[model samples]
Target: MLHNFTYVLFKLKLIQPSQKAIRFWMDCEDTDKLEFALKHGNYKTRKLAAEALEQIAKPCSIPALLNCINDKVQNVSVACLNALERISPNDELIKTIVRKRFNWVNEIREKRAKYEANKHVKHTIYRWRRTSKESYDRVKEQLKKPIR
Candidate 1:
């Protein structure tokens, strides 16, 4: 009962505790509490929860960690990624990450194409300028010597 109350206080911001303490509590094998913390806790708490889940290495925690992979906080996402790696996620998680990776690659390609298209003339001029001076002079002389 006291443990539950302390947890509630922690959740409600009535108490601020160290991440080590939170990690110790999570090691008690309460997946529900760990999941809740992962989903709703502050970044540090979420990170600790992910580490605890990694230490537990329970397959059941895979889904929760997978869901956290897209967390806005980089630390939380990194922790979740590390936890997922340690848990040896199932095929679904692998497929999801692959799909997301492909989508990200496609997006980057599209953006690069757009940028290139927009700057094509500038790129050509820059490339021409970057050539060796001898090659540039040869090209200039060739252009000056008009065809018969």
Candidate 2:
């Protein structure tokens, strides 16, 4: 209970905790709590939660982490990928699931159009820029290869 409240305080910027402390808080075996935070928390919290999941190495986190692979926050997405790697290393099933979830070609076109249409981009909006294609290609290749 205290940990949950601490997280709320952390979310509100009322308390500044060390990474170790945050990681400790995330050490619970509850995938549901972590999943909720991953889906709803701000980028920093989401990234931290991913790191916690990585430490815990829970297979249950795979779906949530997979969905976050396209997160608008690049670092959060990377953290999710790292967690997924740790939890499901060498799993070909993950690769296929990722491929099914993302249609790179279509998503690229769509994100770009949305970015162009928006005068002020929200934190969650994703648009292709200089490294977008390259990043996508790299992620594709990584997903193709069994996690190393």
Candidate 3:
């Protein structure tokens, strides 16, 4: 009865899905749903989905995580970075790429002054943000059919 009620609420879109809801989807090994949440959910939900992807550690999730690694929200971006770090350690190229992103994320924070003043990293961050959003939008359009 409780499950049905929540399902009805979700179907009606009465409230945007919560992080815990996305976590449940993760436990079901529903990567498609996680990808959708990572793109569409608020920062909290996106972070949760990224952490879930980290735990699930599937190669299929890398693209979705990459799409959001430049998230404007620090928490969400860090979560994505962590997910990418764990998911692709065996792949040298991807590991190097994620390391660069991890550095970029750190550089923007004033607390980490090492590269914070680097103009090149600052510009790259903005460019990556735009590129990531565009790719996410494209994927979102292609997946127009609702999740089951």
User: How far out, in Å, is residue 37 in model 3?
Assistant: 0.4
Q: Which clashing pairs does model 2 show?
A: none
In order, candidate lDDTs are 0.76, 0.74, 0.79
Residue-level lDDT tens digits of model 1 in 3-77: 677678877877644575666666688777788788878888888888888888888988898898888876777
TM-score of every prediction relative to native: 0.57, 0.54, 0.65
Candidate 3 residue pairs in backbone clash: none
Q: Write the per-residue lDDT of candidate 3 for residues 15-67, one digit (tens) a residue.
A: 55666676677778878777877887778778888999999999999989988
Best by lDDT: 3
After superposition, which runs of candidate 2 have C-alpha atoms over 4 Å from their true positions?
7-21, 96-148
Sliding window of 10 residues with minimal summed lDDT for model 2: 97-106
TM-score of 2: 0.54
Order of quality (TM-score): 3, 1, 2
- Cα RMSDs, all models: 10.5, 22.8, 23.0
> Higher lDDT: candidate 2 or 3?
3
lDDT ranking, high to low: 3, 1, 2
Candidate 1 wrong stretches, greater than 4 Å: 1-3, 89-92, 95-148
